[model samples]
Target: MNWLNLEHLLLDESPDRLLCQDPDLTLGQLRRQALCAAAGLQARGIRHLAIHLEDAGELAIALLAAWRAGVSVLLPADLQAETRERWNPQVDLWLSEQPGDTRLGQLYDAEPLPAARLDLDQCSLSLCTSGSSGEPKRIDKRLRQLDNEVRGLEQLWGAELGNACMIGSVAAQHIYGLLFRVLWPLCAGRQWVRRQLPFPEDLQRASLDYPAFAWVASPALLKRMGDNLDWPALSKVRRVFSSGGALPADAALSLQQRLGQWPCEIFGSSETGGIAWRQGETLWQAFAGVQLTQDAEGALQVCSPYLAPGHAEQTADAARFEADGRFELLGRLDRIVKLEEKRISLPSLEQALVNHAWISEARLGVVRENRAYLGALVVLSESGLHALRNLGRRALTETLRKHLSNHCEALALPRRWRLLRQLPLSDQGKLPQALVETLLAAPRGKAPEVLEHKVQDDGLQIELQVPPDLACFTGHFPRTPVLPGVTQVDWALELGQRLLELPPRFAGMEVLKFQQLVRPGDRLTLTLRFDAARSKLHFAYHNQHQAPCSSGRIVLQDSATETAHA
Candidate 1:
């Protein structure tokens, strides 16, 4: 992982090593394509290039090509309009794997240029992350810093990884995935998958092909997995690496029971690099050469080779030291609030609530009515939902109140409560504070509640809880209030566009049928699949007992044409 010798990767690597699973690609072929693209970048006089490709192998090639051309790389986290508008001006060119984008393809067919050995500082990278103000904050990293991180990771886990091919859901734009998925395994001569396995079924499928592969996962993907998956097929997974957020205790334990190993949860940020990690343990042990201490305000202070030389950073995260040199995180300093002259720790409250058998996970935050009061967002276990069904909402609330009352003072008790099947985490597995506040302020009865959402490559599956006072059910009553047929069609289109990237111009509907009436308080699972070639969105709604409620095809006009006469 030496910065001076990076050119060896492009020019001198073994020819037979594989880089992709589906295509069964070779390292040499990828390197040649990158070298040609680098030449094109040089010829075009592009200096700062922004890369937002989806394929992992293409992303790696773009990065190397940029570096080889002496062009700085800007790895955008996403391709949203706001993100593009903010970073677009800072970059000289934008690259993506969209249809009709012939820049890279044209370059790959051009005469190849010799790979250039980048200077330790020439191959720089920039990325934007959200700051406290909710605005994007730009962070630049030197090649030296990234190289040191890969080396440190190798020194620690090389023996265990042991030439295993890397595969899983984590993407390459994030720091953790950049290090573990692309750079570390590649530099260590281990084959890496070009596409992400974003589902448990995909993981098991890859395990059958490459029996010795490591998993690069996130909390969101792991949390969505069920016991129905073929877990035994993944028992040969060499290692499991997770980041972006803390892995739930229950998920870790369940995974261990299913796969016979606990995932290695990493603890760090984009600014500080990887600080420490743990294996289903309450405490985190710092990585090699990463010095840790507590500031006067209890914030964790870090000094490591991953940072700029002779630089130290103090993070807002509060930490408590253990006798064995391991540390326990006590959440952020800003998460503590004073209520009735007594301090309340939000994370501590969540931890205590999750300890109860009925509650699987809990998130506590502050919301204001007249004054600030705690709001509890709890993910119920089977027993908790059973109690809720039998005793009703009021009794369920009182039951949780009595359990939490034993652990915290009266001032710290949540005034507002909401139960959910899962936390609404983003694709990157992050639940920000702003989202927490929004969820707390959101009112019921306006729309159906989303209990669980899992996005796939083609489409997504959503579990919706139909509220008794659903706005669409206001007057759609035939003795009993039922969800309107029109409402079901609308929900499919809305969720399809938001989640599945389906086209927006509604042409018409085809083969629409309502098999059963969807009544109030019914739980429904909606599945949406977008067919790009035919411009159709297929949707199906099923009940809790897997009974079909409705199914249809939503025909959409193409981007350049509209069905004006439809």
Candidate 2:
């Protein structure tokens, strides 16, 4: 229940024991490099450091160095500008691998400092959580809390894993990846892949090289594994750990059939750490020393050493405790909504949509306009695509909506629909709420495809083909498909600025006209001319027959100037 004695831990490990591969490093070498970097940070008087490194090896070194230097670490899940800006005040220095940034490699040649006792209670880490709205919420973590969880993991499965190395497809900035891929392995004296194995092919290759290894991954990656992969190489994997979200039953069974092992699914949030895990179609068993209970509303509440000290933390998930001390998760409690004074469950609506033979996946959300209305983003199955091609977008959408009416009230039916070939997922493999809202808010259409492109001295000329199935084409006409006039303006502005390097903020539009109808499948040539002196871009669209379709001038202001104007 105390902080890990990191100073002597790595120094006492076997000098030749493998820690990283591909420019391999041993435990002794890692400690020496980390100590050197710690000395450099001490020399620079960095007390609070923010780490943003992609390479796991480099990240591990920086983390250890900061710990050794008695400096608190800020581990941001993303390197987006907004995230960095929010944390800028709290951090004294940034440790990254970006060019021109302060990096650990700069201190590689510095004199190594003697191992110092680290006060685990004094060590701090800041992690960002992407809440339901996709905004980042900061969570402060103590090293002892993380150490307790890592020790619980080792006690649960460390014996069966033996000397198996660790490989992960997830970034270590997140809690799951940090514990399983970085901290757990280091504390257990197990080797881990130096870099993240982002792709399935990369995982297969690493499996072949390492005879035995534990795979740390997310449900998104697990669902993407198909029958085309090499099963033999996957069989060499000793264990598979999945987190980030719930794994579908079908995906779990598929992995079991192929890899001869069921992936251990971890159910927890960034705040709670690891609460429960399951290997197959059974109730989730709580981890050692973790207690689970239900609130008055049947929502799950967790009390564990892994969590911050206090009363049990209440979770959003509704669950029922089984007689065997395990729990079965019902859906999320927050997903239930009220529409037109009627209670409607978003997840239930999504389930109904997916249960229809045509829909492959569906997500339901309330879109706010003059009044709130339900919206659905759906991925069509093969049969659904055939239906869309045969019946058109309006008919297909109506059919799906009508199918949902069988089980739910009319008010609960989604009024707006966007059919996607595949749902948009973030790099972390989760559907970001902001992206979902953006997709629902934007006019549906296939992005224009470039048929031909030519760079001019001042601007560019390009020919594009507008596909018939573009979302913008839908509902414009029931029987005949025509591109929306507004979509044309959007395309012009988007392409003009993208290719011509126009100013970031839109100022106004001039001389805009929709003289001729642009139908789907029409080939149009777009010409853009930038007037930098006036901060304006002139654009014209003409059909293949040289008939003018549209022309406009868009004025923009530089981002800095626009900000000042606001």
What TM-score against the true fold does each predicted structure earn? 0.79, 0.77
Q: What is the lDDT of candidate 2?
A: 0.80
Highest TM-score scorer? 1
Stretches off by above 4 angstroms in model 2 are 1-10, 108-110, 132-134, 389-392, 448-469, 472-566
| Candidate 2 backbone clash number | 5
lDDT (Cα) of model 1: 0.80
Point out where model 1 deviates above 4 Å.
Answer: 1-7, 98-103, 130-134, 337-343, 406-409, 445-566
lDDT of 1 by residue, 471-522 (tens): 5644565245678888999988988877776666898999999998886567
